[model samples]
Target: MSNEDFLENEDNLFVQKRVPHDDLHELVKYGDHPIYQGLKDDQSKAWIKKSLFEKLDYQTKLNCVKEEAMVIALERYLIPMISENQETSYNLALIRICTTLTKGWFRQFAIDNYPQLINLDKDLLSIARNVIEKFPIKRKKPVLLTHDPETRVIFDSIRPYTEILSFFDKLEYDPDDFDITGIKITSPVNGNISVTAIITTLCKYNFSCNPSASWSASVIILPSKEMEIFLRNYKSSKYELISDLTTKYIFSLRIKANTSGTSWGVGEDIWKPIYVEAKSADDVASILEIPGLTGDLLFKYVLDFLNPTLARNGETPLKHWVNELKSEGAIPIKPEQHLWYHAWNYELKSLFM
Candidate 1:
């Protein structure tokens, strides 16, 4: 085939093909991150330029170009060249790059910076569209912020379903009336049935909150599907499991600023099957209470819950309390864990804050 014919035929061929390059996939899949940033650096950029212009077979050329470097070339150089010369016949090297690195910033930077390429180059455009169609941009979820610290405080209690619903209803009625700085719930994953139901009810209750409330609240709505999966399939060490569960994979609920009405864990890491035995909504009302349950303390709780034998072997509640207090700089010197039981059992005046 003539070079021109090869270019045209190659475009058609690659547009329909799904070439898998592992490094390229990672770079494009996580385009927003710094993983591809090095490609734009001076040394990498030189390498990318050399690889792109080199005269080589298609597969050999692709192998020569680092995935991240290819992405950088397309975003910073190649696409811009194509944008300026839309009708020019790009070589097989350029065509393969476009089709191979089809997602994330590679697709986005092209679409945004050189929109004309869509109309000007059908083969490249089709490949880009395919990637976008396959991996569409996700919409950010609406965050629901509860001003009352009580939402988090009550999370520990075994409240009934109706009572929990009532609490939410009250918040929906006048979220602004409350002290406006407590819990922040950020929904990370989409299509969570539980999250969807909760958000739907929250949106339903036309509650109002202060127009000017700014408090850095705690509480992240971590991705729990994996946690559920882990709980159902817990075949690992307690520490390893807890580490996976508690490490940075957590997300929270966050309320957006200046919105009239905005709407909005425990299994993969510390798979506590006891949580599964809860028979009804009422029984599981407290399942979502996962604020401030981080660090060594959280791991301790999960270990004890999953293995009660360990708890029994450990010191009693009083002993734990005394030991904690004896340790200097232990705020709430009395330690709140003991207070929770005593206050509830003895019906004594206590503070949750």
Candidate 2:
């Protein structure tokens, strides 16, 4: 049987009801156990019973329990089972747990957040990667997601009616193709784990807001052929689009003038992108002087316009710009846009770096 079929049936072996108080205690029992102490030993598996597995599996489905708790429960189970042996039963159980837990939001969440936990064991990493590979790839209808209050505030602040075209991975759409109204943000992957985490977190957040139908749908737009090879062969590269062919971490957002998709506020050539390096404060000056831009009036307008999409990538453009400028020179202008630019210009600027 297929992995899905196996998981679907195995799920029945676990209880499908609310986790009882006793079960929660059982979960905590395993949680307190030092599962991480040993490697490749059957003794580790001795503590985790079938009942505990059922409890962990059942609680994973509940919204009340935080994802970290489920992950802890998973690690607790994994440490023991994987430590014991690579027997068929152990391997199959790992696959089932990986596949079931890494579905929907949890799939992207794991990829975006937990690299260390995944790579902690070679066998464990294989299971996680396999789960990612087998995820259903198809065009899902655009549906609104329920975000927590803080995230909701961030979502609400974003100005509506904008068209963003993201070309990081290719599924049904080609990278050169521009007859679309989506947003593309590429991860500035430089092989450093922390930097990559920042890049992926931003990309995932953007994807969360406007996820494509499949992994292939996010086209990786390559700036050069060399970087493409580096990324594809990088071993831990998560973006399925980077194969020996394409790559780039470009972000573009355009304001839609009306309900009809035809009219654009920036320019008719929406396909042509103006790449801006987030690291350079000088780049913002050049953008301000772009021909057809009304300068002063459009300064805040442009920043506000890009705010929604950029916010997804874990850095606010204006906030970053304002903070960067304070270090360079005296603040200019008193308007709220300029004020926002000036006030935080002197604040701590270490986070994004």
Candidate 3:
């Protein structure tokens, strides 16, 4: 199928529900029938058992739960069972019931708020990568680890860590001492335990914020298994190591005010709090390295970057801007816009070397 066709089908399968009034009422009435009466009557184990069986039978007779209310009831009753049983029928039923009741709420939410959803997905991916790097697994090429098909979704979500490890491992020079080593460690100490350490270091160095920025950097350290173990245990307060190899080539980035002269407001001195002038399309294009940054995207990046500063300075009536860069369409959006607000404030010399 064409991409549009596939998306349309997927949307139909997952979008939110809009039911007819009379049909919805009938479904509610059916759910309230005596046979299914006990489903909502009690909260204990015996009540749950009775409710599950009754709802199942009621749903079976109707060929499905018709009302949104019934769908919710079925979800609460059945999701636990499917999660535990791993039965194909049960899983399918749960998916159907959820999709039916939600009217594809999850899918619609994903579609309507694609940008926000993408950001959240990235955060989840980042967390997953951190978890994998912090907890090393010794699966060699000679032995491929296999998981149950049912758990494939969980596995795929975390597979980025493997790529992250490979990327870090390829960085031969350490950022700390400039020593050449094939291995890249994420922590200053050792092992795969430095998640907390790296985060702590980032914070100690003044780079912690709610939605902190991140970029890649490298550091060299002594090569020893004990050191590895120590680095493994290192945990930073806010910054996290994306990989668990050598401390080189760590991803780090941050957001800061556009403290440049142009952002200042009228009558606002350079020292006074003021809005930074928006970056030209050329400037933003250079920084982002995306040829198609439209005027709007450049405005977004600048505004987003300066959001915290604006809030702090009590800037009012915030305006978002967009500019077109010659003819390259819209500038490519930054994947990690959330992290742009919390920046490291120390001088380059103080933090490195």
The number of the candidate with the highest lDDT is 2
Please give the distance, in angstroms, between residue 343's alpha carbon in candidate 3 and its true position after superposition: 16
TM-score of each: 0.18, 0.24, 0.18
Tell me the lDDT of model 2 at 40: 17
Write model 2 residue lDDT over 119-216, tens digit each, in one string.
22224334423433553223424323333455334333322322253443343433322222222222123212111100111221111211111111
Worst 10 residues of 1 by lDDT: 263-272
Scored by lDDT, model 1 comes in at 0.27
- lDDT values, one for every candidate: 0.27, 0.28, 0.27
- Residue 131 in candidate 2, Cα distance off native in Å: 26
User: How high a TM-score does candidate 1 get?
Assistant: 0.18
